[model samples]
Target chain A: MTPESNPILIGSQRVRVELIDRPIDRRPLSDFIRDPDTGAQAWFEGVTRRMTGSQQTDRLEYEAFTPMATRQLQELAAQAMDAFSLTAVAITHRLGVVPIGEASILIGCSAAHRKGPLAALPWLMDQIKADVAIWKREHFAGGQSQWVHPQ
Target chain B: MNCQVLLFAAARDLANSERIDVEVPPPVTAAAVLDGLGRQVPRLLPLLPACRLAVDQAFVPADFPVSAGSELALIPPVSGG
Candidate 1:
């Protein structure tokens, strides 16, 4: 399905997962706010780095099976909330070309304690790496590019 | 009947197309669909064994029975964080 037709796969107002074509603003740590009762906020960002183990990368191109990706993302977000006893969680992933230093994927979670938020963010990232349908292609400085896949 | 299998990323570049349609007989299992695709596009055969089949937007095993006209996609090992 097209991005416009991509459904908002939300478990609730507290859990938000979305795929955006444009750049993501990490300033707000996504649209998730630190409500009055929430005592901690944790964020994890997957940025396009210039060096990927020595191969200089100029940018990254991300492609996703939108329908399935969004669905899985929503499921992951909801699970993170329950497992971590979180107040809110938001995940935003970028699609298309992303220049170096831009955040390609960002996740933010709010919880009652620092430990929960800190623990949950890394766990959530692992799930995305294992199951998410999005793919990342690295464009090297020499103009060569290749998709990142299983070894 | 025939079903279309959507391709993506490295698989897409290898197949040289966004999708491929294959003739699948009755009792359309995920394996049957992959076999059909491999016969039609030999280039994609290498990736079939390593890939998972997504039927109607959900991951299914090779023997999983798929209904006619359900959307199918070849999902390679993903790398995202």
Candidate 2:
């Protein structure tokens, strides 16, 4: 119901992470926003982009070392919760070949005020990119593909 | 003893094999298994530094002991959402 009602686990505890070839559910946005106590529910969804600067992208493929990736992501979420005092936080990352405009990562954080979740969202994303055991391959229209390294 | 090492993501793709059974001397450590893996799958050399090892879905440190019949997986850096 409310973000406060759904408290996320914190610390070096266990968390759930799965790798599926199917599409991700977009309902979490509405679910997280339905909280009455949440003064701000900030969400960031990473979708496959069709272009990057002057380069036109055809599609993208994602791969992950599931165990390590899951562990890292859980750690990030836990840290964010402690640092920001977030009410609810959910992150779902899709694997495999995701076409253009499809969601890759869905990050939601709800807090009593806008600043906490707002600040935590970008920080969490940066941590995920820096530490998580995930990699991406960008496929161009000319049948060339390159592994996208972490920035 | 021989234990199967499961590979995932880039490790799996580079090794060209999903799983490999590595034989080692008694009382092996996670590090030893990784050493054996390096010899078995030379392509994994570049990935070892960034790779992490897990036993039955739980991440373990390199010095951790490897029991007989344990299931180990070599997890390369992931690129998921």
Per-model TM against the reference: 0.92, 0.77
Q: For all candidates listed, what's the TM-score of chain B alone?
A: 0.91, 0.89
- Encode model 2's per-residue lDDT on B8-79: one tens digit a residue: 656777888879888867568888888888887888888887776778666688889989866788766545
Candidate 2 chain A, run of 10 with poorest lDDT: A1-10
TM-score of chain B of 2: 0.89
lDDT of 1 by residue, A45-119 (tens): 888889879789988988999888988888888888889888888788888889998898888899888888899
TM-score of 1: 0.92
Segments in model 2 whose C-alpha atoms lie over 4 Å from true places? A1-20, A50-56, A65-75, A131-133, A146-151
lDDT of 2 at A22: 61
Residue A4 error for model 1, in Å?
6.2
- C-alpha lDDT values of all predictions: 0.84, 0.73
Error of 1 at A98 (Å): 0.7
- What share of the reference contacts is kept in model 1? 0.78
